[model samples]
Target: MKLALFADGHVGTQIADWLLQHYADDLCLVVTTQENSITEAAKQHDVPAVAFRSEQQVLDFAGTRSIAPDLGILAWWPQLIRQAFLDFPRHGFINTHPSLLPFNRGKHYNFWAIVEKAPFGVTLHMVEQGVDNGDIVAQRQIAYDWEDNGESLFHRAQSTMLDLFRETYPKIRSLQFARTPQDLSKGSFHHSSELEPASQVFLKQTYQAEELLNRLRARTFDEHPSCWFEADGTKYEVRINIRKADS
Candidate 1:
């Protein structure tokens, strides 16, 4: 049950802490990107920690240290892991994605789910070379109301991810799980740049109120760029706050 963890961000840090609490003895290495809370958490737990800018660096470091882990877990890790690294772990690699695969396979999956009206959820899957196009190990659907925006959806997905990991980690540890291949024909993948053009809310274009509302909700991430449109050479970003009317 030796584990190698690669993760980033607040949710990543939380997952790392939980793993340390539950499987401290099995944790072999904690790998993070740059100096973040994940790195700090590893230090707090006194777990061996390292930071790598790319997948190659991780592979190189692990090779140099002769570190061989039974399982590699990726929580909110942004880098693209290749086959070499995937094979480094005895049981291969597992990752938690914000959306159910093979839908919303790329960046900003939470935002894309709302914008595309796709099934919103979280997925734990066996990592392959392709981006999020992997065999599903476990998944859980997240519920959202009209009041939910991109940031809220992200938080919900993050919570679901942790829960899914907790539920599935035991099965994985015992090697008592089945691999479910994703239905490639049933899902869609998008790149980060693909959403940029659609994120613009054109004032001159006649869009339905619902469409505009969905756009605003999808793009409303905290401290991040929101949906915008230019008018009279002036750009304006739009944010939506939705709530049910008083009964």
Candidate 2:
């Protein structure tokens, strides 16, 4: 049961470490966007590692590998995986997504959850042709309060997602998992391009306080680029921290 891992970031490093410790012999390949902890772990274990810069490189590598993987795991992947690469793995790929399916299907799951008042959670699903329009293997709906901001929600999702992968991957490896298709009409999707327009704060435009606050808190992640406003031919980014009033 050879496996391939496509991963990036902190959660990606965690996933890579777990796989290396538990299933080192079974890990056939490691695909990454940059040299990080994931690549370093693969090196220690002697697993084949490649840095993918383009969709074409991924496709070309797929064609050239001598051993085809039985399954692929996508953890915090940065690229848009197409059907061509999907077919390279014998059993296809499964993704550990940060949002509950049928809601916030694309980028910035944490931001969209608060902005749109959508249900937030983590999902482990089969990676299909569409952007996260995959069949669910398992999921957990997270509870969030008004005090939760973009940074908090993002960390929560990453933690929950990693836990989901830990619990679900064994079932997946044994071929005991099920695939439940997502209803596309019920969910919202966003492209990377959508964030700019949504994050723009028109100083002259009137907005309901609730709506404006939602937008502010949604983009409140300190590490990420924040919502912005322009005045006097200058642009300024804004991020707000929310909390319950101190007793």
Candidate 3:
């Protein structure tokens, strides 16, 4: 039941802490980007941690340590793992994605889900070379009302993903689980650049209120770029604060 973990960012830190607390004995190595909270968290647990910038570095670290992990877990990792490293683990790899795959398969999935009106959810799947095109292990749909926005949806997906891991880890540990192949025809994948055009709002043109609102909500990640429009050579960023109406 030995495991290797690859992750970064806030969700990654939380997953790392959970692994340390619950599966300390089984964790063999942890990989994260350099100079981040996730790296610090792993070190605090006294786990063998490496900050890798590329796939080659990961291979080098494993070779140096003479470590062969039984399973590899990817939580909030931003890079594409090479097949050679994917094969290093005895049981291959599993990843957590913030949307119901084969929909919203790439970056900013939470934003794309709302904008496209796709099935909003989180997915745990077996990792293959294709981006998020993997066999599904488990998934759960998240509900959102009119009050929900990009920031709120992102947080909800993060929490649900963690919960899914907690619920499914036992079965994975025992190697007693089923894998469901995703129906590729049923959904779509978006590249990082695909989201660019959606981020721009045209103020001069008449747009449906719902469409305008969805765009505002989709692009409104905290500290990231906001939905914007240019009017009279002046650019304006849009933010929404929705509340339930009195019954």
Candidate 4:
């Protein structure tokens, strides 16, 4: 598909790089929020592109492309896509969300899924005016383990997303894929601002040290593990570096 990619950070950069490397002939324009590492690399590859502070710039740039795309996919766009701006794609527009949709529908879902012990999956869906409210194209549920932490979950989910696009989006473009409206009742959305609070583990709630340790390992953040508070006037917190999955 000739694409005009609208995206946010690293995922946008990485996915654009993949498309640029594998399907350069089809990429129309790559639109991103700012010039970051991905944008730098995009320039190195000499890809057609635009970086802007607002979605309007992306919209205006897409207007300049005479050729249409077979499928337009949003990898990690932070901004919203207004209807007038998204109709540029002739086939349809699809998006890759970190969490499985109808559930974990918004940002910081990776950390939330780890904390909540929910499945870490990727959702590829049609783009709508609303947040992640679109027809489901494909989703792959990955089991979250006792040792699954925020950064680990993100890395694993990141790897799965491209595989998802390679496997699913192409089929949808070929019309061999089916479209199904999500069960609105089965899912929920969580915003980014709500996730800024840190997780605290209390020793008092623990039934066993091993179980508590297991759950503690499950909720570790990228920079640090969940801070633990003790009944005494001292704290016991762990900063996890290496991921030592149990053999």
Give each model's whole-structure lDDT.
0.85, 0.88, 0.86, 0.71
**Candidate 4 lDDT trough over 10 residues, lowest sum:** 195-204
Report the C-alpha lDDT of model 1 over 66-155, residue by residue, as the tens digit: 888998889888878877778888989899899988878889887888877888899999999888988999999887778899999988
Give the per-residue Cα lDDT of candidate 4 at 216: 54
- Candidate 3 lDDT over 95-147, as tens digits, reads 98999888888888877887888888899999999899989999999988778
Estimated TM-score for each candidate: 0.93, 0.91, 0.93, 0.77
Which residues of candidate 1, in runs, are more than 4 Å off?
35-37, 40-46
Model 2 segments more than 4 A misplaced: 53-65
How much lDDT does candidate 1 score? 0.85
Comparing 1 and 2 on TM-score, the stronger one:
1
The residue pairs in collision within model 4 are 2-26, 102-187
Model 4 C-alpha lDDT per residue in residues 74-148, reported as the tens digit of each score: 888776778886676776688889888877787777766755556569888889888898998899987775556
- The local distance difference test score of model 2 is 0.88
Worst lDDT run of 10 residues, candidate 3, spans 35-44
Candidate 1 displacement at residue 227 in angstroms:
1.0
Q: Which stretches of candidate 4 lie over 4 Å from their true place?
A: 36-47, 65-70, 196-198, 201-215, 228-247
RMSD of model 3 against the true structure: 1.7
RMSD of 1: 1.7
